[model samples]
Target chain A: MRELLRVSAPVDLGAIDPRSTPGLPEATAGEHRKGWAREQVALLGAGLGRRQEMLYATAKAAQERPGPADRPAGRVLLVLQAMDCGGKDGTIKRVAGAMNPLGLHIRSFGPPTPEELRHDFLWRVRRALPPPGYVGIFNRSHYEDVLVARVASLVPEAVWRARYDEINDFERELTDAGVTLVKVLLHISYAEQGARLLERLDDPRKHWKYNPSDIDARARWDDYQAAYAEALSRCATDAAPWFVVPADRKWYRDWAVAHLLKETFDTLALGYPAANFDLGRERERLRAGEAGAGGTGEMNGR
Target chain B: MRELLRVSAPVDLGAIDPRSTPGLPEATAGEHRKGWAREQVALLGAGLGRRQEMLYATAKAAQERPGPADRPAGRVLLVLQAMDCGGKDGTIKRVAGAMNPLGLHIRSFGPPTPEELRHDFLWRVRRALPPPGYVGIFNRSHYEDVLVARVASLVPEAVWRARYDEINDFERELTDAGVTLVKVLLHISYAEQGARLLERLDDPRKHWKYNPSDIDARARWDDYQAAYAEALSRCATDAAPWFVVPADRKWYRDWAVAHLLKETFDTLALGYPAANFDLGRERERLRAGEAGAGGTGEMNGR
Candidate 1:
């Protein structure tokens, strides 16, 4: 799954089909593919919960290492980017939601507010990173600096173009700070987006979601695709690589993301922090309340 | 449900039991109460999706309301507060998660960062309110000013005490700005909290969640209860109402919050905006590519 999904080099928008369902039984029909993906997600869900807890435990251990630490405790940030109707929210619910919310932090970046725009693109993002022992999910992230800014001309050609290396450097610094960064781009075809946009228009319950300007944006579909391909190629790195998850099928997208996260957590080889104090004594003290606090600490020299 | 849960009058914390399950079927066994709460939530989940659409639609209509609007478009902000081990995250996943993520914004406030502490307590919170069309969920909110600061004496006695009416006035200003403010206090008993804190210590998977300082805070339980009582008495208001949700039972807590959110959204009488353009012509234009664009201007004078 990692090799299938990971964009190891710059992306060529024309070569990779959005309809590709990597790592799946290709011969299966659409229904069976979805069913198989859902089944895999169910299995992944259980493993993910355990792995996430371990990752959390790894961070806790680092914090309590009882000395100045050279390395940061483990924390993961999953940065997600997608087109207007791409399934960022669904992926969050289906994949990340399976983890314990106690250790999850989700931040969705919207069009910049007046204050956010006054600062550099990465400023607000810097504030949203998950603390140690947590998984931070970015619904859309700093990639917007290059992707949307380039496609929509939100910034000048020179300005948005300059952000690629800046992004790479920023991500390197994050990894150096003890953050694991997994960037995913939910890849969907122009047809798929148009179909989803039409659904929003057709369904009254969905009308609020449709921005007529999206149609204007859709008119510039090739431009955005070109922008995404450029960003994917320029910014993906060893420390914070990008994956183009096939998102035409929602379940496939969810499965691919879950797989990526599980792989990432597995690489961390997370484990619980060992008890630093006498467990039996603490248990006894807790059961007996304050009167027993000093009674059980003789051997530990408390 | 509103009368039962809403703090229409100044709250008497002692009078409201943390175990109380208001508006629920009476005389149910523990298992049945849990099962029943789950059942109602499943039903409310469907209603909630529709109501939230109406809310989003209401915002769209206001933006296109054919006049200079005196008020901002409508939105909802739910500010949540609770003690350690309270189920704020669980409530978010159960209630707000059911809404369309397109229109939901959630911000979890941790201990103030140094920059945040330099500002007044409400400064950061004011920045997190949902934009005109969204439902903003604060996992912990400014009530921390009155609750934790008061209990822990992090600030001077006079400082935290004066924040009560300041908070009320702040909320009133928000309502006047067209945001429906729903403040919830997830009220749980000290015994329940102790049990939860112990579970954090006993379970390796939960160890990271247990803070030693929380034990010191737990030692000041009565003090927090007093603080919560005073804040509730002072801050509950008609423009921005407070609901003391009984949170000893996770299922009941989830159900009550979902219920409150559904009621709030329904009261807005939300509806989709009238098609600002000729829908028939717009569909034709979308289907024919750009050839039919200018023809969509008959009835709505677009």
Candidate 2:
């Protein structure tokens, strides 16, 4: 499934079919695949809870280790990128939403604040990075500098093109600091995206989710696609690879994400910290109470 | 119940009975007080969940308010202090633990690092404060500068004495900025703490919780009680009044904390962010999704 879905090398995204559902259940004749895909997502969700708990515990105990350091405890960051209404928010709700908030953080990148713009593009991103022993989900992440900025001519061609190497180096630095990078590009066809954008306009409850900029970008779809293809090809490395997901079916998008997360956790090889206190002396003292206490404070009495 | 627990003005440390369960149910002769208190805690927990959710939503919408600014959205910070085995950790697990992690963060303070020691005592504390819309729980807080620094002779009498006004002014700044501060000192009896420390030795799983410094602090029970009495007296104000929680029994402690939180939320006058988007345009857009929606990329000059 991973081999079929992952883009280890550069490929023309235009050749990929967005509506085609592969690496998931085969569509039976006259069958509702949403129900089946939803069931799979549920099953994956159940397993995710237990695995996430262990991962959190492992992360907490990593600093005070009396345990194996084979796979050092740290953070896993999942970066999500796609066209507007590409189900980044939906993916967050269905998959990342199941996570423990204590260790799971979602950072949605919007336009840069004045303070953020005062520094390099990565400055705000650096601040939002998850602390050790947690997972961070980035919705419409740092890639926008290349994707939107290049397509709209917000920056010159040379500058946006040069960001590919910078992003790769930045990711490698994170990997060096015990971080796992899961970069995903939710691939949707041109026609499917137009439908999703129009659907947003029609649903009043979802008006908050709609942005006017979406249509302007949609007007330059080919440029954005080319930018994404270039970014995915250049930035996807041995340490951090890109997953090009077929996202016309929201359920399949969620299921594949959960599957990828499960695979990531499995590789972490997490375990609970070992207990490191004397059992016998502790028992004897418990029964004795303060009769066996008062050694230190007495020495430095007020 | 709140009047009984809160310290609106200066109060005596020695006069207050730690064993007295005045604000909670009395464990009368053959009375199932534990079961009753547990039931009450559960009820409060359920209400806490709902109120907290509203607070979170209200906070998120505060910045985009077409709503009243009279009760603007903000953050809540709970500062917990007590001698060893006074149940700061237990209080966090049972109380703040119930709130959504999306907006609830707990910071456990230990000895200052070299960099921290170089800054003002409030520097690190200010940094760990909950971001707007969050509930930040401090297991041990900056009040330690006055309490431990005074009782242990770590600083001159004048240095610790001067910190009282500093803390008051700092808290006043936070209150002005819309943060609600709930400061609590979990007051446990000397004998009860000795018993808890001893019991920790008996349980293997609890060994990780037992620190050697706990016993040292326990020996200075009288001194710490005096330090706490003074700190509470000097710092308690309208914006951030101090609550002395009787922590002999863990259930009662958790219940009182939750009760106080419910009171805080009730006073917040929190309302959901009002719907302010264009409903008519949204409905029209939704209807259009099934109609004219498939022209881009090829239609564009791309």
**Reference interface contacts recovered per candidate:** 0.09, 0.13
User: Which candidate leads in DockQ?
Assistant: 2
What is the C-alpha lDDT profile of model 1 across B46-131, one tens digit per residue? 77766766777777667766477766788889888888888887787677655555567778887898999999999999988888
Model 1 quality (TM-score)? 0.83
**lDDT tens readout by residue for model 2, B52-100:** 6566666655655556577445788889999888888778756754554
How much is the lDDT of residue A152 in candidate 1? 79
Per-prediction count of colliding residue pairs? 1, 3
Q: Provide the TM-score for each candidate, comma-separated.
A: 0.83, 0.75
How high is the DockQ of candidate 2?
0.21
> Compared with the true structure, what per-residue lDDT tens digits does model 2 show for residues A1-302?
55677885566787677766767755542367777777877678667755766666556556655466765566789899998878887787667545544456667798788898888888989998987777888888889999888887877888888888888999999998889888888888766776776676665434444555566676677778888988888887988888888887788788888888888878877654444545666555444544554543332122
Count of clashing pairs, candidate 1: 1
Q: What is every candidate's C-alpha DockQ against the true complex, given to 2 decimals?
A: 0.16, 0.21
